[model samples]
Target chain A: MLKVNEQTRQFQSGITIGELANKYKPAADLFILNGFPVAADAAVQDGDSCTLIQKDVIPTPDEIDSFLIARHTPGIQTKIKQSTIAILGLGGLGSAVAGAMAKIGIGKMLLSDYDVVEPSNLNRQHYFIDQIGMLKTDALKANLLRMNPSISLKIIRERLTESLLPGHFSNVDVLIECFDDPVMKAATLRSVLTEMKTVAYVGSSGMAGFGDNNKIHTKMERPGIYIVGDETSEARPGMGLMAPRVGIAAHHQANQALRIILGADKGRK
Target chain B: MNITLNGNNKSIQEISSVLDLLKSLELTPETVVVELNTTIIQPDSYDTTNIAEDDWVEIIRFVGGG
Candidate 1:
């Protein structure tokens, strides 16, 4: 058997790299066997692995960043770059999560938010002073594109509702629930969990105030359902959503989403 | 009747159905997930599923704010 791009293929006797490509992927111009570039005549043996590199295709600067990213993470980068995550709210958690995902090469992102960036949001959200009056979805999109030009983004400026979620999330791999209102959060979860059973759900709960950083952690609520936060913190008049704790929870959510995409949370569900 | 709601032990009158329990806690059924013992109860069955004494119930709702 030969491992090709992480998939096992039966090794045929008396076959060369050129012959195999001719039969399977006729457009292939380069073959890498066992971590070395091989010629058309190079022989493939059982238990060997192969990678096909497209001919005459040069990676742009953004694509180069993706290459380096995947190069560092080994097996995880491919899945990360193939994932499509829908962030329902582009507030503190959603903004931070989107930025982190873009940095790590998340292939596509769908951001939804109807609210404009407020002056108060600058303290904890990922927004600049000049973006105070702009829609959060637009601002976050601009920031994310600046970070990863290769990212495929779709933005919805309207308020998200159960009726609208299906059209936006029908093909998403993961859903990050980031609404700031308890009612909206509950509503989104209620609809999405029942409608889209296959999509992974990563959410945050009780991530308010400046308290022990250790309290922020990831919890697998059920199969395909993960929550990141203290699981008990609620924002009050005095106890607020600070940057430190909110960022911690957002990182937990982002990390969990990545792990889910990479199948790292497979059996641990 | 006693039940464990969200990992917390609580004593309440026999709430009759899952819908009753949600209403007693001031929660809207559409926005909450109810787990009885270890099985998840469907949202439509909230009014039909009964809550027994000593039942372990998890009333989970989303926390707004990131």
Candidate 2:
């Protein structure tokens, strides 16, 4: 028995991958044997898994999903596909977080951003130069779809206030706060931690300046509340937001979301 | 009086409420999230919530940036 793109089939005892591809899927131009790319002449044995890829072939949604599952760690893709994540403030941090989540095949995302993509945002954000003047929600959605089309998105094109948060994020498994304003960050964190106690909250504090990357860290302030950053750096005159440092913090938030989804954060509270 | 403030044992002049505690630390109420005894204290209750001795208080100040 052999697994081919998640479908099991009985094949000859010792057949070359090229022969198998010719017999099973002749259109396949790329071959992956047991999770690694291999030459066509690689041998496939019993109980081995192979994924055949055809260049220029548009895969179905199920095919795309199956491919993602094959690439992820065993038994983790299901949980990732079932989780819904909410990202507030689609700026440098939020945009990068959304991109990472989408690549991991998150089931759904609740995205809220009221601002448009400006020229300055191109420096650190995920938006392209042509996306200038477009709403961050729309621009990010377009870019994310290019990565994973099956991801479900709920875009809110309005500023998030304390009163508006519960209605938008009450159902999400994890709520990530990515606002750039200090006041908004404090207010949003207070609202979610106070009102939505069941949601795992990840917030960012200091990702400004081209300082030491080691200074940025993910600290679980309390159970269900994680803050990632150096805890002191602020974006002001002389200390500005750069890509490398901001990307570090954004990926920290993304990894925390994954950890929470995979139950790694459990029992720590 | 003595209390654990931001994970540091600090001895400060006696204060009454959360607002007063903020004043002692020089932190503005609107700019920080105050958690007392593992529970988040709403901003509106800062004037009414009291800080008992040995209470674990975690105050996180928000700085501008993504």
Candidate 3:
């Protein structure tokens, strides 16, 4: 039995990937055996899984969804596609998180950022050089759409006050706090934890300078509340925000969001 | 009075409310969230929420970074 593009079929023993492609998908230009890319001449063993890709092919939404489902662990993509994540800031952490979630095909995202991209932000943020001077909300939305056009986005280009947090993110499954200001971060976390008891909250504390990568981590402050980072490294004049540490923390938050959405963080109070 | 702070047993003096605890720890109320036992203490109520002996308190302080 050989699984090709998520469909199982019986094939003659001693068949090669090229032969299988020629018989199953004649237009396939690339072949992947198991999880790694393989050449056309690669041998296709019985009970092996293979993926055939046609270059420049724009698959339909259903095809794309199927591909995602096939790539992820069993039943993971379905949960990922049904979850709604809200990011409160669009700075270094938020931008990277949004990029990760978009790549994973999150069902919807509520992104809020009041600031515009500046040259200073390019050092660590996900924005490109050309995106400078554009509102972070608009710029990030454009970038995210390019990555996954089918992702639904609701972007707000305004500073999020504590009063607005509940209303804006009332329906989201998870809320990520990526603000650069400590006051804003605390306020947002407090509001969400108190007002929106059902929504899982992932907030960042410290990802500054070039410290030990191992120091960055995810801590569940309580049930439905997670805080990522070293808990102490604040961005300052001497120790500035760098790409590697910030990205590490950002991905930690993104991963935590995924965990909450996938129900891996179940059985907590 | 003895209270659990961040999962560690600690003894403090004259800490009556969440605000007093923040003041004793030198953390500003604006930059930290106080969780008493398991209930999240709102910022406005920090001054009025009293701390009892052997209570579990988690004070999460935020830093200036994304």
Candidate 4:
């Protein structure tokens, strides 16, 4: 028999459950709900007997990069350092994906792209005038470094052919499918599945006059591999992909990646 | 036939190859991917892949937002 409220106090003393999360929003995030250590808003059951918890959001990739290179790189764990990620394209989705990864402090990244900045890209991509006509991999690498100077970056300014991919991609922990081509995305999906057993995340939509990129639905293919902004699989969209739409897809991809790394996404997908 | 995506069906098309169908719908390869009968067909192969009658083809595109 389980005894709840053993150390029970008064008034504010209540057990955590799926319903109570709304009230104790702060502590609700840290409680282990549904058998995983997650935020307080996670669910629980009556008489489950759990403890309250609290957590702090970490700094963005830019800050972590500076810190690691200047101070903490040596101390970070090998499991984390050994974790490698591949970002297929460097357009709207890839740019956002890179920013998210850098902020979350992924140990290493394989940023690959075979495009250059154009005037049209300026309207949506995370690139500036000086970067126009410059290689996307170069520009992204510069920005990524600014985000986290210490990250072990292995950038490939080439298309992700099977040969080029076999080396850098084989040992990666996760692969972010942010490529722009439908063929590339399709070919890429098959490529990742064939190469390593690494968890892969892909961006599916977002490319139009002016679309919102933060609201797309992301799905997990493997328990860990996920695809964000899937316009069809989720029965969500049936329109032309636009800028913000792809951005939303990228955001979902990023959110899931972070959730998985922290062990918070367990069964929550 | 009735269908929904994100939830809406702006236009309808009745055609053969996905490329032709999309062109008839005025959709471009740069903006979307064709989901024919739950299978995703790459834009490069849109010319060769045929869309069967009554096939549920989902054309998805990118829209901008934060």
Candidate 5:
């Protein structure tokens, strides 16, 4: 055990991240929402100034950091370093997913969203009013680059069909399903589940509301097939995806991807 | 009973079923994923997926973004 000197924050040795969350519930909620951890072993060095640290205000632990045990956990920066994911939609869920894939340091991303930003999208979509007429794939590209200049992005602006998807899925490790039409989404899922032989995971998302919710449904089929949000969850004009909810789903998808890449048992996740 | 939920330990009533515990997170039946002791519990089965005192659960969300 490390000693916490006068300069140290309150000592919380050997406390699991979650236990600390309970001790500081508000902070914990924030951390969980943001995908941070509550690792109790984290030390505030003597003489170092500190502030209240809410452990949950971040994404899942990608690698074991100083606060959390350092494992090459899949979603930590490491898995993003090791894998490639193909995102199938670039609207509400797709844009959020793409932005997250870059911010979290995923190695490569193939983004496909045939839609264009509309004046209506400004309310919930991440795009700016200035980007209103731009194709979603292009707008997303510009936005993602701003988020992480080093990310490798492959953009496809055309609406994709089953045939178009296969060529892209060629070397992809994971598939993120987020199509606009329910029938198309189902078709894409079925196609990927059948044809993408090398794919280990497929993550789907569906969120349509103003609030950033921590609530969403994610699926991991056959180890690598994962889904986030409800692809079929239709968003009404005022109820389309808000940043927080979309962000939460994006965070979870990245976490699952990192976990799988690390060989960390999905159960361990 | 003490068990882990998303890497943190918490004390739940010894008899709290997996479904009951999920209700505490305020996740809708349509959102949220529940993996109890490594198995992904289907939505229809969650109402009956009784969590053991020693079980480990990972609760994740699927929100829309970007």
Candidate 6:
């Protein structure tokens, strides 16, 4: 038995690919056997699935986007597009994480930030100069929607507290702690980890100064808590949070979030 | 008495409880999470949890930047 575009058909041994193509009378000159391109002279084996695509057929722009994304990482687009994540802060880390997740086609996101965009944020954050003075959540939502229009964004413009986390994160699959305050970060993390034990938490810790970039890492702090960065560097008076290292940490958090959602990252507790 | 604090071996005067340890370090208990002997000591329990000799304690605080 064979599957032709997911339909069952009787398997015919010794049938050349040319014979199968002729019998099917497909409009295209090429056959994709189980997602692999095959020539007309190739042998057709039993239990093979085939798809016929016209030679030199150009895919639409949107189709090309899907094809390229799926080609690079097969079976990830669908799953990523169905997963929901909640980003607790919308600063450099959260903003970049949101953009990265949206680009990967995450289904939905819950973004919370109370501050407005400032000129200082342009160095590493995902906002443009024109967006300065706009609420971080609104700006981030606009930016994410612009990239992936179909994404579901739940924007919260108030300061997040331990009390408010559970209510807002009821439907999210994972929690991302992107706050700039160590106090708030600890508070939010403790609240989420204790209240939402089932949800995975990806956080940033030590992304500061122009220190060793290689030191930045994603480590499973506990069973459900994952922290990215060196876990040592602190922003000091002379040292500052530059773009390169910050982006690295943000992407690390974002990547952790993606892998957790896809079941690719199982933390060692 | 001696205890391992945040991976560093520290020599401290005898302390009655986790709260005493935080007070000696000048750290407000509200700002950090304490892990004693590989177990997280909750903030509410810090006052009552006694500090034992050679205890492995991790004092984790938040990083202020993203």
Measured with C-alpha atoms, the lDDT of residue A159 in candidate 5 is 74
Candidate 6's C-alpha runs over 4 A off are A1-69, A72-74, A267-269, B1-12, B23-28, B37-45, B53-56
lDDT of each: 0.81, 0.89, 0.90, 0.59, 0.61, 0.79
Model 6 C-alpha lDDT versus the unseen true structure: 0.79
Report the C-alpha lDDT of model 1 over A4-31, residue by residue, as the tens digit: 6444578998778777778665778889
Per-residue alpha-carbon lDDT of candidate 6 for residues B1-66, written as tens digits (9 for 90 to 100): 888887899988785698888898887677677778866777889899988889898876666788
TM-score of each: 0.73, 0.87, 0.86, 0.54, 0.54, 0.74
True contacts kept of 5: 0.21
| Clash count for each candidate, listed in order shown | 2, 0, 0, 45, 48, 1
Which candidate leads in TM-score?
A: 2
Individual DockQ of the candidates? 0.38, 0.76, 0.81, 0.08, 0.10, 0.51
Candidate 1 fraction of reference contacts recovered: 0.57
Per-residue lDDT of model 3, residues A16-35, tens digit only: 99999999889999999999
Relative to the real complex, the DockQ score for model 2 comes to: 0.76
Better of 3 and 5 by DockQ: 3
In terms of lDDT, model 3 sits at: 0.90
lDDT of model 2 at position A151? 91
Candidate 2 lDDT by residue in tens digits, B1-66:
889999999876665799998897887788789999989998899999988888899899877898
Q: In model 1, which runs have C-alpha deviations exceeding 4 angstroms?
A: A1-63, A70-74, A267-269, B2-11, B23-31, B36-56
lDDT string for model 6 (A1-269, tens) is: 87654445688888765677677645668778878888887778888877656667654446434643544464776777778899988988999999988877787899999999999889888898999999999998988877767668888888877788888885677889898888777777777556676778887888988888899998887766788989878777777788899999999998898888777886322
Chain B only, TM-score of each candidate? 0.86, 0.87, 0.92, 0.67, 0.84, 0.84
Better of 2 and 4 by lDDT: 2
For model 6 chain A, where is the 10-residue window of minimal lDDT? A59-68
